[model samples]
Target: MPKDAMAQKRGGWIACPDCDTLHQCGPVKAPHDVKCANCGRTLFTRTENPLDRPLAFALAGLVLFIPANLYPIVTFSFHGVKTDNVLVTGVYRLAEGGFPGVGLLVLLASVLFPALYLMGMTYVLLCSRLRQYPGDFALTLRMTQGLNRWGMIDVYLLACLISFIKLGQLATVLPGPGLYCLGGVLVCTLLASLGFDPDLLWRRFGARSDKAGSWNLLKPKAS
Candidate 1:
């Protein structure tokens, strides 16, 4: 039998050679593996990393989250007057500056999103670890995925750097310890998210099993 035919006979994971799209192989699988439903990539063999690594990263991210939220994100000065702004303070400042929208956006992006991502991921990790079934693991997974992209502390840090460089001549702009902490938080959380294995979650949560009708696409092939 051809490789594709063989794949159909025995269930397995396949990656498209042309575009690296992931596909679950079996009789009950989605139609037409010839073109990846996600990226239109031709089907090919591929390997997936185990879930333990991502679980570790998720735990580390939880630890870093505390400091990320506690520390000051930026500091500013003008003509001998200086002020340090934590994440919430910055949002308030933005509102005071008549930029309520910007302030709310910043708060959502920096404060709200990161916290939600961290908490959500933590819950996923813990629940998975305990082998406890959540009512809506799929929904939680989606929220975590969405929040992960918006956790833009690095971008905000770069903006801080640019602002400091521009204002240094007129006023000093020194980075506080919190800035470093926030960076660590961002890096750790990013690593955690990357390390997390969604497949593992499904397996542990009983979302994927032989009884689930042979095969169901857990995650779409990445383009």
Candidate 2:
């Protein structure tokens, strides 16, 4: 069954990040540099190694992710009333306050997606470092892409800052360890992305199927 799925997998075909132009780049060499024919945008460059800087940042992010979730984001002291808000508590309170949809979005954007992205990157990079192809490479790529897109820790941070500012008028809102840890995670995630190239996965995946090229993945797949 895996073989059959692998057989159907096609190779090549990349998109320009700038102008959305599609290019069919057959087989690229190491230091895989390719420019989009339409927009002159560099699509894929540098065949990344898992043991490089990207891996380091990703590992660091994973380490910080734990405390970011466990620790309190902020401590609110209002007229001798002390309330410490952890990340999960914030989500729970939001749901309990009749904003379940927003709470769910917050949970996914702030907590679940960020952790999944870090884990996914670590897994894929480690597997590549060991010269192992994932069971379903395309699915893994899609998952990571979705996770990356949804991981909105920055948004959460913004909301926290706004809350701090607004609440500070009437109460003392002290920044907690979780806030600092989350900042570290966000920085690490950005750094990891700067060095890691998902396109490198295509180079390895192309080995299995070379008869045709990948179609327009920008379009959503049919259910």
Candidate 3:
């Protein structure tokens, strides 16, 4: 029997990440969400356009990423003295001001992990689009999973905006290109996260391979 037929016959199972309970499901169509039978937690949503949506947004986010981090987030001028701040300015300032721990948190949450997550997501999705899973694909996917929760770019962006408002009162504060770029990347990443469908990946990369079609199985059913 073909692996595809075998998969269809068994109707693959997905384990609830929250409760370790298993649920059997078939090839569900888009515009529907699969919820865990035990925990009622949403396992994943079937997007109308699966890899394409995340791929496009992740690419857009990547395009803006360099400028977002490299350029000045904002500029402040007081009495003919002007200074420009980039995304990492807060981290540096915090460390210099006796808040090393806070600075590290800012670095990890707002900058490092988020950048890695976006890059990994883009690469993983791109590989999926090309139907070529590299040796590091699984590793990259796992990295994205751990890094997703730490992306606090929006929080840091909000902080920058507040600083802009307050510094405007004290001096001439101007929004910089980096600020706009950061905002764009944030929106793109948010949309990418929303549209990402992990099940597609499971089907392509996690299933047992043969001459037959694929199975979208993330975890094996309990014995």
Q: Give the alpha carbon lDDT tens digit for every residue of 93-133 in model 3.
A: 99999999999998888788878888998999898778789
Q: Judged by lDDT, which candidate is best? A: 3
Can you list the residue pairs that collide in candidate 1?
A: 54-195, 54-196
What is the alpha-carbon lDDT for the whole of candidate 3? 0.81
Roughly what TM-score does model 2 have, to 2 decimal places?
Answer: 0.77
Any runs in candidate 2 off by more than 4 Å, and if so which?
Answer: 1-35, 40-42, 47-51, 207-223
Error of 2 at 95 (Å): 1.5
The local distance difference test score of each candidate is: 0.66, 0.76, 0.81
Best by TM-score: 3
- In candidate 1 the C-alpha lDDT for residue 210 amounts to 47
lDDT of 1 by residue, 90-136 (tens): 78888999999999999988777877887777778777666566687
Residue-level lDDT for 162 in candidate 1:
87
Best-first order by TM-score: 3, 2, 1
